[model samples]
Target chain A: MDALTDAELTILGLLVEHPRHGYELEHVIEERGVRNWTALGFSSIYYVLDKLAKRGLIEAIGPRTSAKSRVPFAATEAGREQCAAATREALAEPSPVRARVLVAMANSAALPDDEVAAGLAERRAALRG
Target chain B: MDALTDAELTILGLLVEHPRHGYELEHVIEERGVRNWTALGFSSIYYVLDKLAKRGLIEAIGPRTSAKSRVPFAATEAGREQCAAATREALAEPSPVRARVLVAMANSAALPDDEVAAGLAERRAALRG
Candidate 1:
């Protein structure tokens, strides 16, 4: 099977901490600023949860009820195993820095020197900020 | 239009340096060890070249005749404009490190503590290497 998408791993990882409903998961993600690196949006949380359920990576352990009602999920044994493996792979792997900026930098000689330097300076500023 | 894919941007960036054919492009990528950070592979080079050409981010400037005959490609004016925009977006973007390992790290409370430490140690060793 194809490796779990980043969303899958993240959601599953959260579920590992404890059973959480969609709303709680969404809250944690936003509060923690996990959204910065993730394509996960508020709209997609339920969809991702469903996808995880269908894959048997997580299961509905119970329903969470307070102001809202939603199913709570926990990792399956297979999921825990998968998560560990995925974690190891993610941590150890040296996936390419596939940034378009890096590509531009690589070929900066083709661009005007001033533009290249200015762009890099802009990037540095952003990184610092 | 949607932003250029990483492969497209990388190939276009290479073209920006100078017009090059399939083999020369392949040689540069390998020589510089760009494969470490990129998903680019020798087999997909031609396909990526074709994709860029179709998008008009690159155009066939001429045929390069050497030990082998191949078409050489260069960035167009539109391509250059797009490259600059893409470059800025990529540079200024603080895209999340979407590694499964990170998810694992975040949810590591669910895993045994020793396993987490060992995994992290393994990763650190790999990075240091």
Candidate 2:
């Protein structure tokens, strides 16, 4: 199987910790600022959960306590294995950092020096935020 | 118009320097170690050039000097303007660095502490290379 995407690894890793309903997953993701790191969206929580369920990497466990409470999902053995392997890969392999500014700087001859300097100033200000 | 992709930006940046055919552009990319930074592929050079030509950001200039000499492409006025704007945007914007390791660390509870430590050790060695 292919390596899990950041989103998949994240969701599976969370499920491996403990069974959680979709709402709980969303809450955890928000509390942890997961969105700031990965492109996982609020709407994608259920979608990702469904995908994991269909893949048999995760499965729903236990009955919902109430009609409003969604069924909780837990990682399967396969899911745990996959998540661990992915985590190991993530830890071992550093993804390339593509700095767009590097590319721009390389071709800065495309613009005047003053303009490039101004852009750098703007970038410094943006980064301060 | 949408911002240029990394491939688009890299190729256009090179073309903005001087008109070059596919072969020259390929040579420059290799000499500059551009692939180490961007996802631009050896084969995708022609494809990106074609896209730039179609968008009117770049255009064919002059005839092939020989059967071996490929048609060269150069950035047009519109192309220069766009490249400059994109360069400015690139310089002024700092894309978020999404470190997958951070996510893995956050959910490191998925694995044993020793395993996590081992993975990090492996990562350190990998980064040293």
DockQ of each: 0.27, 0.35
Determine the backbone clash count of candidate 2: 0
**How many Å off is the CA of A101 in candidate 2?**
1.3
Query: What interface RMSD does each of the candidate structures achieve?
Result: 3.8, 3.4
Q: What TM-score would you give candidate 1 relative to the actual structure?
A: 0.58
Instruction: Estimate every model's Cα lDDT from 0 to 1.
Output: 0.72, 0.81
Task: Provide the clashing-pair count of each candidate structure.
Answer: 2, 0
Model 1 lDDT per residue over A1-129, tens place: 657766778888888777888888988998988865555766567777887888888988774453332677888888888887787666656454443455556656666777767777877888899
> What is candidate 1's lDDT per residue for B36-127, written digit by digit as tens?
54557576688788878888889887744533327788888888888767766666565554434555566667667777777778778878
After the best TM-score superposition of candidate 1, give how far the Cα of residue A83 lies from its true spot, in angstroms.
1.4
Candidate 1 RMSD computed on C-alpha atoms after optimal superposition onto the true structure: 7.0
Q: What is the C-alpha RMSD of each candidate to the true structure, in Å?
A: 7.0, 7.4
Point out where model 1 deviates above 4 Å.
A1-8, A15-27, A35-77, A89-101, A124-129, B1-8, B15-29, B38-78, B89-101, B125-129
Candidate 1 predicts chain B with a TM-score of 0.71
